[model samples]
Target: MNESESHGHIPAPLGSVEPHAPLLSVPSDGQLLYKISSVENLLRSIVGNYLHFNRVDSYADFPGADPHDGRQLPKDQQGNSLARFEKSPDFSAANYYDQSRARTYACCFSLENSDFIWKNYANGSEKGKVGVVFEFGRLRTMLNQTLQPGNAALKYNGNQCDQIFSVNYGIVEYVDWDTHQANVDHLQNPIRYTYLKDKERFSEEKELRISLSAMGIGQFALKDGSMMQFPSSLQLAFDFKAAIADGAIQQILYASDSDSDFLQAELHKLRIVSSKG
Candidate 1:
């Protein structure tokens, strides 16, 4: 057995940033109840609508997983040990998320406040703060197209009735199994991050408008000969939600240093605002 298998856990090697795990959940308010049928309708209403991803405040993204430790989990048919998130392949994938690529995409999510994601990604360690789950309709569209994939192509009706889908979350790590350290050393630091005169200063905003360029080529190579890719960046808007107790949200916006320079640091502090602001 491998050393990790012998010990029954994987340790986060030193110098690696925190692990990136998104929250998952379902609702429990007594005011509303969902039948399998009704949930389908509600989802259908927005089948073609767009959901947004936001830049996460990684340090603030806790009340979450233990970065240094690992858990004992089940294995897949191929002998790949399954993390809790990958156990329910269909159900979990539909509501998944990850923020590790924020260095380039300048976007990530948390379950700190999102109860819905917390319940679904319900391993004791997986806590999500991003209250809402943006369910992707599985309707792949090309750029500037008003069209959605035909219904036959979506995760709707028939056998796919209860199966919603999302690739927003990350579970598989980009590390070495033996060392459990980042497989690629340089990629750990976002290229744009170097431009900051003050790594701590962020910005202020309610809704965010991310352009296509803010996200770099969006793909990087790992030491293991595999490529790491972020979810394609979409033109999304973060309409201010009512403020919660977290002080003004000082987030990092990872766009190109400017519209003109995708190579420099566009990473900075962004103070998120509420409608009340």
Candidate 2:
């Protein structure tokens, strides 16, 4: 058998990130739960929505199966020996398969916090923060848009009830292997895609109305450990976003660098709020 045949892997779709293999050993501290919980809480706080975490596991029949390693699967179908040996068909298209058949990992999810962030804040830099604040009706608009049959909601419906009826019992007519497979990736991944798409609608280029000096801070530190007082000639990066249902901020790092000339840095989301009139 060829080297690819000896290993078990399937080609990933273009632009999609590679999946990671199951951990051989159990995680030691279970701190992953805590780290994930913090993110969930941040999400909840930002968007008044809840976040949930779920994991899937799989084993690697060959090397380079770890998700973080970034070793992409060979394009040829030779890498999936387990499937070939079992007389299974190739799985290049997007669908759900077992762990024994291919590498697997968990996918955590929550509502699109970027929606809340963007709509709450005006399209430009207000005061000192440099991100959108979701509008009052934006979440409602997003939910209405999402649930409009054949949209992302139908994909997440698990039963495909809505999708099936859209074309006169189309979903029921095609529930089997010949028709479709139950894959949650589309539903789970759309949050980021939706966020990016929404971001494109806003033109925040010239609306920034705040100065770096106006941001409240006694001291700041650079990655190089350089320290400086506030309100100096040096520039600052600013970012802000709404919390998810679980009260956690969406992944920060959405703003651009303030200093275009001499310095460069992305701003970290600040958890603490300061009050100064």
Residue 106 of model 1 has an lDDT of 27
Q: Which parts of model 1 are misplaced by more than 4 Å?
A: 1-50, 56-62, 65-171, 174-178, 183-277
Candidate with best TM-score: 1
Model 1 / residue 182 / CA error / Å: 4.0
Candidate 2 on 26-52: residue-level lDDT in tens? 122211111112232333333433222
TM-score of candidate 2 versus the correct structure, residues matched by position: 0.20
Q: Report the C-alpha displacement of residue 232, candidate 2, in angstroms.
A: 43
Reference-based lDDT, residue 169, model 2 = 5
In model 1, the number of clashes is 29
